[model samples]
Target: MAARNSAPEKRPGLISQIKTLLKFTKDVYPWLPWVLIGIIVAGIALGVGLGFLIPPVALWSIILWGVTGLMLGFLAAMITMSRLATKAMYAKIDGMPGATGYVITSGLGRGWHADETPVGVNPKTQDAVYRAIGRAGILIVGEGAEGRLSRLINEEKMRAKRVAPQVPVHVMYVGNGEGQVSIKALGKTVKALPKSISKATQAAVIKRMDSMTQGMASLPIPKGIDPTKVRAPRPR
Candidate 1:
């Protein structure tokens, strides 16, 4: 009974972890479909070779087949879904105020839960600055005219601080202009951070930020984008 009950308790954590890893895989390989196919073929080839290399390894073959197949399936799904997710995210925010910032931050910082939130919108022009929520803190990324970005960043920062005071906040202006964080280097910038920080620290940062930004949610998924239409994973 204890073993039975423990199995159920352990399953959710295992599943969620697999999901999180898959999400990162998708983000890293958004444009690689053939790579997924290659992985499946390779996994099968390896599995077959191992099965034959050892004499009458039928039991071992079955176990290896299942494990290899599942991993390859995840790789294929990650490839298809990563591109789909990136495109979907881009489509929703493209041409909106702070779109570039949103996209850059979306791809930045591995191992941290990042969210792009629309907190302030200009009623007249429909322009907006998105709050980029990450482990480091809340970054108010401005997307409109360069001249107006400072004000927008400030306002967004103030709003974010009211909710999450403990989290250190940074305001960044995204563009090619001087003193701004360029879009191309966005991934490099975030990834360059020291890996010494433990996952617990990152989680605590996110928790504190969430506590501060209570009630805030991500912007609605854009119309006409079917989240379900992602490419099918290669059959295992």
Candidate 2:
């Protein structure tokens, strides 16, 4: 008998991936197709203009430049589509509860340890606090009205302080209101924090904090939206 073959499944082809991305972005951004076309046209124009400035405009030179322009145009369009798709995804989930949790888990890049589950929640008000530990130490993000989120944020901060006394704990709320960070800016804000802890220290802090909250009851994520199903494509 032939030996059993074990191979990883192939990822979707590039054309298929682009189609999926285009469909998703178009749904959220109605003007995406036109915007992409404009970007591609501009890129091609720039490339061809550069070619014309370099030497005598021969037929071969024009063809070469035109092909180069077309390739560059597509490249620029793909990049713009990727960024717009990301923004559109965030906009789609902006006002939903647990959106912060979703961003924390999926939006933030590597070197950050965070869970999609909020560490503190107010069942009555549906307000919650999510936590993340990185080189910046601890980040506590609250979702809901600032007033209702205060208690939850405070409680989570205190828990972090108690578990890792030396580690710094930063708090911020997610919303369009005063003193709150918008969902689009959440990842940027977290990444901007000064790195105050080493990788070893970050690991220790996370382990200690996890142990402290291990026994606490896990709360159900707010209803009306499923964040896991809505993911932004990772940028190249």
Candidate 3:
């Protein structure tokens, strides 16, 4: 009875979500035809295979294969939508000093304890080092203008060493410069680090890492700007 009563509220929300997702994809890529064509081609291939495999196929069997193909196409469209949403997201926030840290603790999966405030920031140059602690251990990511990140990374290293000398500290730079890794690749770079501690140990180390957040400069760093939030991205 209670479930039936909530159906009205639930359906419009679901419809609204679908509409928003479709709109976001349409606006960002503006190449929906290519995706549609690819999905249709895959669906048709599946239908053709099903037609060949079936015994004494009738109208019903044909309809079933068609429906199955449509379902597969729908799933493909969802995956395409997700990819486009992610690309659109990174494009908006990529170069900011806090971008590396923002993506890490939010986009990266659980088991990570990442700080929201950056560990090091040069008010003038905007060069900054953001911190995160996880099963992989302490990560210090630096981003700013060319040559600025490297020096900030060095400064942050010394501070981290002072606070927790025994814990492993990894440094990463986000930019297109000589040695810097791209923004989108930040998650992979962090995960690739040696697993320096267990989950329980990660908590304790993260607690100690709180000391590194002291005296961080305030910058106009943006937070929680998910590109997919055309409205319905957050759920009740």
Query: Per-residue alpha-carbon lDDT of model 3 for 118-225, expressed as tens digits?
Result: 666777766667778777777888777656666777876887788768788887778877888888788877777778778877877776666545444454443434
Write one digit per residue (lDDT tens) for candidate 2, span 80-195: 89988888888888988888888898777888999888898888888888999999999999888888887788888888888888999999989998888999999998999999
The order by descending lDDT is 2, 3, 1
Q: RMSD to native for every prediction?
A: 9.8, 2.9, 5.4
Compared with the true structure, model 3 gives a TM-score of 0.78
**Deviation in angstroms for 232 in model 1?**
14
Question: For model 2, what is the error of residue 162's alpha carbon versus the real structure, in angstroms, after optimal superposition?
Answer: 1.5
State each model's CA lDDT, in order: 0.55, 0.85, 0.69
Model 1, span 146-216: residue lDDT tens: 67556667776776567556666666655567876665555556555445435565576567656755766
lDDT, model 1: 0.55
Estimate TM-scores for all models: 0.43, 0.88, 0.78
Task: Please give the distance, in angstroms, between residue 40's alpha carbon in candidate 2 and its true position after superposition.
Answer: 2.5
Please tell me which predicted candidate would have the highest TM-score against the true structure: 2
lDDT of 2 at 194: 97
Q: Once superposed on the true structure, which residue ranges of model 3 sit more than 4 Å away at CA?
A: 1-12, 41-45, 211-236
